[model samples]
Target: MLLLLLLPSALLLVPWAGAGRIIGGWEAQPHSRPYMAHLLIRNASHKFECGGFLIRPDAVLSAAHCVTGKKAVNTTVILGAHNLKKKEPSWQVFHVGHWVIHPNYSKDKKENDIMLLKLKPRAKLTKEVSYISLPRHNEQVKPNTTCKVAGWGWTSTTGDETSVLMEVDLKVLSEKVCENRFQKKYLHQSMICAGDEEGKKSTSRGDSGGPLVCNGKAHGVVSYGPKYCVFPKIFTRVSYFEPWIHEELRKFVLQDLPDSPSSD
Candidate 1:
């Protein structure tokens, strides 16, 4: 049986698998992934980072655990960034206007682990910054599907987090295989699994909240992995939350519209 451990907590004792990097991946081409968003979040005690991706002109999709239950006091989204350590001309920074975590998110079970951040001012779309398309309505990916997962973080379990963006190719595993590997009670239906079986390549301590892009569509949100990231990792299956995402986007648009004129 596999042990159940949160990536953040595991990172303290086991410096490798937590809410931050890519393991066994290579540097991504600058601005190649325009939808990518790097998050700098501060709580009362300290500051941390998480990965996210632009989903709309003013919205970003990420893991709920990245913000909620962490006492996140303030969060900033940086788009069009290639090397986080350098302030490039393409960077578009925005203060979070608001955020919405899934209503039924369960920290213990790690279910419904997704969230959306609304930018204070809508982002200006350009060649270097835009939104990634989501999975088609109710679409599902099959086993053995090759996908890409990208983020700014460690490229190895024992390595330092990288400043430049990195990405790796992963293969989706079947639901049955995932259940057999992870604790059944902790593994929810809404989550998907992906990674290399040999453990050669996987998401590590800083890759959380990043996307699993399958066939050019945003299909999953990086959730968690084992202490050493030795096998396939868990991701919040985006298709499961499509309806809720669309609904929230609709509400946001409605809120932005001017009030209707008074009746005569």
Candidate 2:
């Protein structure tokens, strides 16, 4: 039996995952997370509120909620960026051609929190820009396995977003532990749990829609986190959605993607 969440909870989706980087993390190298791509809006109030990763030459993986109601034409994806506040030669921006959010994604339940963006002009694979490797279908990460999560999220829970990209290491916890600690009903099996109880590391404000890499393969997507970034973070299990990703990407790039030397 599952208990209904009767509390007046807005379910604050923290924008960043790195605790001032996921609490006790550090700044990552410029090209460490090469696949990392920050999302921006077209308006003058353009903000790097969300994060993403390049899974293919013309496709980017992100959270469905990031573009749920927004116009796809106004969105842009920036890649090879080490710092958002500084101009770097490695950074390149591209317009979004199409938005492919998961069909079953729900705003209320936060289920299937994944989406894919098609770039207008395919990105050129370079030393500072490349695609991340996705894991095989249905692969499950064992408990206590340390994985890497990087983003331009806030440096602290209540702080502003980080100017430089931040990367942090988190240990994967079993689904049962996450359910028991939080609301059992809300924690879906398609989600992965990873965090530190010591309040040392966590995903903070504006770190959503980033990748969670384990054993050198992207296996999770930063979907949500606890209030104020104090508890373990919840990520959409990438392995569980492998089929959706492959299907969506195949629609764009049917031919084989050229192999390029990655510096990440």
Count of steric clashes across candidates, in order: 6, 18
Best model number under lDDT: 1
For model 1, the stretches where C-alpha displacement exceeds 4 angstroms are 1-16, 186-188, 260-264
| Per-model C-alpha RMSD | 4.6, 6.0
Residue-wise C-alpha lDDT for candidate 1, range 151-245, written one tens digit per residue: 99777667676899999899998776566656553354588888887767788776689999999999999987666555768888898899999
Task: Tell me, by TM-score, which candidate is best.
Answer: 1
What are the runs in model 2 whose C-alpha is more than 4 Å off? 1-22, 42-48, 71-73, 186-188, 254-264
lDDT score, candidate 1: 0.81
Tens-place lDDT digits, model 2, residues 1-264: 122123224445432333223446789977978899988755445444678899888888988877775543478789999988997988889877577889999876668989998875788899999999988888988889999888775666556556888888888977765676556434555888887756577766566788889998888888876454456677888888999888877766643356643211
Error of 1 at 44 (Å): 2.6
lDDT of each: 0.81, 0.74
Quick one: how many clashes does candidate 1 have? Answer: 6
Write down the RMSD of candidate 2 (Cα, Å): 6.0
